[model samples]
Target chain A: MIWNERIECATRDEMRIIQSERLSETVKRIYHSVPYYRKKMQDAGLTPNDIEDIDDLRKLPFTTKIDLRDNYPFGLFTVPMSEIVRLHASSGTTGKPTVVGYTRKDIQMWAEVVTRSLCMAGVHRNDIVQIAYGYGLFTGGLGLHYGTENLGASVIPISGGNTTKQIQLMEDFGSSVLCCTPSYALNIAEVIKEMKVDISKLKLRVGIFGAEPWSEAMRKEIESKLKIKAIDIYGLSEIVGPGVSCECEEQCGMHINEDHFLPEVIDPETLEPVAPGEIGELVFSTITKEGLPLLRYRTRDLTRLHYEECACGRTLVRMEKCKGRSDDMLIIRGVNVFPSQIETVLLNMSEVEPHYLIIIDREGTLDTMSLMVEVQEQFFSDEIRKLQELRIKITKQLESVLGISVNVKLVEPKTIERTAGKAKRVIDNRSI
Target chain B: MLIKQLSVFLENKSGRLTEVSKILGDCGINMLAFSVADTSEFGILRLIVSDPERACKVLHDNDFSVNLTEVVCMNCPNEPGALAKALQILSDNQITIAYLYAFSTGDSANVVLKPDQLEECIKVLQEHKMELIEASTLYKI
Candidate 1:
């Protein structure tokens, strides 16, 4: 699972050489194989020869998710389907899911990088790894599955769902490492409390959570409940999967595998590179992806890149906690609102349940925002006057917190539809 | 028994009351017996609407968290201690009331009861020979 440690811990010259070589080859592959890439490159009046090195990346046409989707299926593959070993794609709402093909070489590389990611997270060969992400075409499951195997760790591919079964396997397998989305992890912890599962009997030592963006508060909460260190994993279907980057034991930021993937931060608006430390949209160039390679892929994932050496031995680039996707931001009355922000506010509010929805609609020409909040039954003596007073308090709190006047409607116990997967918290009806 | 109810999960807020009502008015669902169970940040608006299912869907489909629950409804007098008389009847029969709310149907006060002691409450209601309104009868009344 050696992923070019020199490039990861490269001296300035060696790093430049590695990027220059991979950047050139990626350009050549896209130009030769992908019709969409060839068209985009032709439109830019560029050829594979023009992108001689990493600095010449400016000369190359940037590949976006739209390009991948528009082309669809095997449109981006550098090789034929016979050469491809596995296919993975995004489960994002609709259309021919952005498909990715992995050559046998590509799968091995993926397993290697994923293993590197786990090792960076302090997972050793002896640990029992429980992967709870969805399998099938989704990369989270199999990618981690192979990676844990690559790490020579006993992997329980529990997959996602059936929380009771997940617990059963964790207890039976005596899993030492847990992997799943942070929300599901939290839900599992909640179930354990209700069922009185002996968490102390569980051998889980570390948990890696990703697939959806979450906050530091959530991380601490998960860590405390599981009595294990919780770390963030960053990746998307377009680039690789869960192992493109991951938080090290340091937990300062997720370490991006610099040799395989080159990271950049760009102004989402200007489409220009942002200053190093500034928060902006994260872009990745798959310098080494053989099948379905993407160059300067606009991840739309908002994060920052830092070249600082981590406390761990790895000198790979580190990415800050993703704030939110540039696309996921909601413009309510000219104010940019992120569902994560609302979640942050709600999680902080002891009075509110974690379940909530932000409803945006057109009231005349202006926008109206209403948060449907659920009140705990125990908190109220079932008194109406106090309930009315509580409602007013919530409204005031939302206004203060969001810096926008929002109406808060109180809900009863378990009224909101519990999301079985990712919570659909934002409903924007302005389009209708 | 069948009764009008709006089962909306609401985060507590000042104008939220006005908002759901305004939407329901637009949809033509009248709020009959309404009670809000509140926490600090959110509240649940439990209502007996003229149409239970329609009201539930209207609130739910609009992203307002809604739920359905069944409770016994009784028509009592508007007079003071009328509720006490009912409570005593249940207490004497060792019935525990989980929660209750009052709403007026014309001049008569109808008490909504969600009893903790369902069997005892039913026994007391039957022993006292209090008229148990059928779903159709309650809807028509």
Candidate 2:
């Protein structure tokens, strides 16, 4: 296959030369317009001039979720609220939701980044893309909704939750591309099988699954079932949503749109920056966003950065598929096991449903993980002996995937609760 | 004429039925007739215990979600088509079987069914042409 050579061939010196000036201008804009940025810079004893180059980004104070909340609504916005054309927010799981705003230019830039991500995943104007993510304050749906439309593709805005309806629309409308959370994508695939909706008969060519964390095993399963390319998109509502970076056709790493968003890996423990190719929290700084131009925003997502050019000709910074979050990491048996890793293995198994709950409990001093997985009706045996056998298989899979042995409980169909929005996969019940 | 005293909701699981059984057993309440209506989420544990008020309190105290029902318990023989003939009676009166379950003591099987679209299955039984057995008759049996 012919690789995208132009982007790959761009000299590092030239890329840095471009990122420096844009980064400098973004720093100046935030510092002048938003009081939050002014205070952050003042406390750090740094001026916009101090951030002369990308290397000087360390001299700047890091932005965080608390800062966003402190500046609730639009206080942190660089532009006036009147100029903002659109706004989005995160799932707001902890407390209040982190909202984002987009100006007319920012919306165009968002569409551009999403389009770039889609192109790397080999989507085209000829494809009929289905948007299944939530389309409200949550950015997953609307971001992709606009980007797919902007790309000139025939858009099917099947805003999530009604799996049967999504399947019907996919088949009836000849949708060639699907975008939703990874778990939902797997769910739609299951419904397609039960409904016997011929995916091959449909026009689906590629799938961009994101919003919540997923694993490679899920990607592989979705690919086989839908018989199309499955790619992961990375973004948070604080920065933008579902379009900061995306998987290239090679599916190795997600190509970050370095032109708009600059990514950095920071030592979460030390609050200092780490070199590329090291696992650390991924940080991003938006250059062209009007509503919220985050400078050195701590994404809290753990991943390694790759500065290499992609097969799809895009001169952008790239990051590996995120390993897991620092907060959600379960240190069991001297190893950190991500629930997504366990999920990956389960999705690969034919007997398991993608719907599962990672129940974290304390057994003595060590943390114990019990995977509550749903089985299709046929394999759901009530006999404890049969359930034990199934549990053992899951335990082996977990040990192999996560390098930690965990107890797997085979739950009956629909035993695990389903969420209408982002699915809550992990239930850490360690406190009580 | 009599009414089935109670229909309690219980989850269909290992210790669920055992827990309910132990509650009534410990309360010194004799189950004159009892049956279970099973489904995926939960089952209705219908009973015509000798003292339903005491039985309801015992089961409720044990955390079993209970409901007071007035179901018509029909005594059917263990012979072929015995259930068919009894069910034909309800069908002839257009009484739908919401759910039904059976439990037999030595001689007769007490089948409890909640007729369809009726607030209480007792009123429907009164409308039918069958003789209703009362609590005393159930205790004597």
Candidate 3:
């Protein structure tokens, strides 16, 4: 079920040529139409002519989230307002969101890539996809919606939340495919069990889960609970939401649509490209995007890329599941820790639920990290000593893995807040 | 010989106890006997309620972590050495009481005991002719 096989199955040489030609055009367009990009290029003493091929990507200055914020709304858009047909923005926790625009052709291109992403996951024209990702300002909802429609599949565009309705529609519509964040999928599974719905009666077969990084252990949990094959799809709103790459049925790694979105992994400290297949921060260059053709945008997502062709017969470069976002990496007691590492450890244990919260605070110049975990109901004991022993066991494991002592606090089940979108796992109280 | 006790997990904070009491009070669930084991971080609120099953359900509905545990409830004379004599019987038989709490009513006191060996502790107490309160009678009171 390889959609757009001509580009998806292109050889390395073929992809390189396609990428080089598109990248050259994208660079020239931004340099001429975007003052921000033109000034950035001028400051770097580089011209659009210098970017002759994909290899010349290093010559251009990197675009970061801060740069997008500084430009604000429509500052970096290459096309005029008349040409921009749609806009989607990623919500910023502190201030204004990062806005991205798309022309009519751009939207069509988005749908094409997303359609290819769905096909990679084994979805076809006959399958009904229930898109549970949040709609509106976020790109996940509409991004997946158009793609599902583009694939000629039936789409139940019932956006996020309203768990009961989601389940009802799932049962009524006989949706064969599901799309949403991994956390929301877990929440749906929990609700289904609570409602005593017989999952066998549901026709769901495959799930395309993304928008946030999830662990392999979580994938297993979702698979066993929902009785469906959960495929990981990776994308951010900044560089054409959720269709930048997606895992094929092979399930080894996500195949990046490199012909359209050129991928690079670089060391955050030195900004130099990491050796092939090495873990580093991911950067993207929109090769064929029109409305918002970014040069080299630092995605801040950390992952490694595999150049070998996948068993699924797609020669698109595959990226490992994101380890964690570099921005989410916390430096506590001078030790760099990612919430995903703690998530991996928690998911491995059978006595605790996957829900957890990491709280970091400063006391008298000493940094402290306290983890609150919920004990499984079956594991709860009337005796305090037994519960205390479980706490100590968790603390010891975390200390050994994190190389820093962590205060483990045992909370009751459902104590941690669950969201329909990304789960907030860390709370840093330290002002500095 | 065996009674159900509702044990709840409460984080150490102001008004948490009030919240639990309010939930039970609103439902007309009476607390027969109760105890709280506290730490700096959290507290375990152990309670003997008139309706254990209903109380557990209501508390759970209110998002409180409540569990039903089996404990031995015995009636002891409301006088000095009465509790000690009953406890001495279990101590003599090498049966350990993990924790115990009591509430006095009229001439007798109702004592709830959670022992390391529940069945063995009940057997030892019955052999010694200690009057154990029936769960039904305790709930009625």
lDDT of 1 by residue, B1-141 (tens): 434444565655567788789878888876666787766665567777766788767765665656666778877777888777878888887777756788676778888887766556766787776655555655545
Of 1 and 2, the candidate ahead on lDDT is 1
Fnat, model by model in order, equals: 0.29, 0.00, 0.14
Residue-level lDDT tens digits of model 3 in A1-432: 998999999999999999999998888888898888888889999898999988899888998877887888888998899999999876432235678999999899999999999999999999999999888777888999999999899999999879899999999999999998876788889889989999999999999988766678879988999999999998878799989999999899999989889999999999999998899999999988988887789988899999998998999999999876768766554344667778777877787777899999866334689999876556776667777888888888787667669999887667788889999999988654
Candidate 3: chain B TM-score equals: 0.98
Off by over 4 Å in 2: A1-10, A329-432, B1-141
Q: lDDT score of model 1?
A: 0.76
Q: Please give, for residues A41-158, the per-residue lDDT of candidate 1 as tens digits.
A: 8998888889888878766667786677677677778898899988876533222356888999999889988988898788989999998887877778898999999889998888
**Model 2 steric clash pairs:** A4-A311, A176-A203, A176-A204, B1-B132, B1-B133, B1-B134, B2-B133, B2-B134
Residue A302 in candidate 3 has what lDDT? 91
Instruction: Quote each prediction's TM-score.
Output: 0.61, 0.61, 0.61
Residue A422 error, candidate 3, Å: 25
lDDT of each: 0.76, 0.73, 0.87
Scoring each candidate complex against the real one, what DockQ results?
A: 0.16, 0.04, 0.21
lDDT of 2 by residue, A67-142 (tens): 8877777889888888998877653323345678889998888887787777778888888988988777677788
CAPRI accuracy category, model 2:
incorrect
